[model samples]
Target: MPLNIVLLDDEQHVIDLLSAYCESIDAADIVGRFSNPIQALNFINNHPVDLLISDINMPQVSGIELAQSLTRDVKVIFITAHSDYAVAAFELDVIDYIVKPVLLPRFLKAISKAQNAISASEPSTKELGNRELSNREQSARYIFVKDGGVKKRLVFDEILFLHAQGDYTEIRLKDKKLLLLGTLSSFQQLLPEGEFVRIHRSYIVNKSNVDSVDKDHLNIDGQDITIGKTYRQNIDEIF
Candidate 1:
């Protein structure tokens, strides 16, 4: 089925452009289009919205705020002229965030991503309690995080651990480190349950990547990370 999509932007022209792009590929059916985010939100509450394409820096309501207001299973793709809100979009688990003058190829790619995400989330005959299918699902897990101007796509298994650096979170892999502009709690939300545990206020380690665990710290990728008193329970439960 084609996705039920809503396009929202303060600029009528932007909404028209997005509508045209979606129309070109027949990627989605434009169920709604509104210059006011409030109207869009209200419409979404009463309708089936499979995908939401919105401009982030609107005057009525920021796209980030609009995405946060919804409490349903709708996929979101954010459009903005600025890259300032990418980290916030990341925390919200948005499918894709495009900066400014949305191109046809990029927009179609985002729609495709949303379609795949929706399809993957739905139960199928092959995924019904199939252990091998579960392992296949694990292989497809990944997220896009910005490292400076470049967006790095890291598979879940490649991540060794995560560390809090005040306002930024450090993503540690076996070979490199990337500091994303968000808190550890934000990154923690992106990880799968039971696979990653918060060992300290500043540290979260992947259980699969840990070399050893003692009373005070855990060794991961040859680096020692101290476990906090409060989070010892997390370690115990996971271990």
Candidate 2:
């Protein structure tokens, strides 16, 4: 499942850049983006967030103080134009401290660290067929995908299956299909491992939507998908 992220920056342009970067990564979802530190804190208190990227030099409630006041263990990454606050920011044990303007490579490196920390701390997340690695994971029920130049929300339960088309993925819902600009392997990283299974070279089906299963074929939404030879054993174990 993707990480829920919050962005807090006093500047609107900075927030826009961060939002675009987060959307491009596909490994995270922007749960909230605020220009006011106080408002961002309120939302973070009431929501489940995995990471927070904040500008340290805000008018009210500096990012250092905000990180200290968090009610839960949410990882923080401080971004500031001035390097003078680095010492104080690190005292709060933040994930990373980034200096503005935040470049793409630096942001990606920090995100990778946050992902590692979250995966280690996650109490119940599935790792493909290894149920023993974790119990049932508490994951977001939906994901955001851009389609037709507009971002669309796709619920996990509403999705029937996924079809790989070279570098893009076709998400098959009950009524319509939404295409995403990503490979099937990359898209799988964002999916709840327990809920979806790779049954073929080009298809991944929602386990709860399965109607029938045989040695070579599995049925989902009344459509039969041939099970890949390598994945047949997984089907047996999962079913």
Candidate number with greatest TM-score: 2
Residue-by-residue lDDT tens digits, candidate 2, 3-52: 77889998999999998898899788776678889978875764456799
Give the least accurate 10-residue stretch of model 2, judged by summed lDDT: 125-134
Candidate 1's TM-score: 0.51
Once fitted onto the true fold, the runs of candidate 1 whose alpha carbons sit more than 4 angstroms away are 123-239
Q: What lDDT would candidate 2 get against the real structure?
A: 0.81
At residue 108, candidate 1 shows an lDDT of 78
The alpha-carbon lDDT assigned to residue 179 of candidate 2 equals 83
Per-residue lDDT of 101-154 in model 1, one digit per residue for the tens?
A: 888888878888998998888663322333343345466687666676677887
- As a whole number from 0 to 100, the lDDT of residue 5 in candidate 1 is 82
Candidate-wise lDDT, in order? 0.79, 0.81
TM-score, model 2 to reference: 0.54
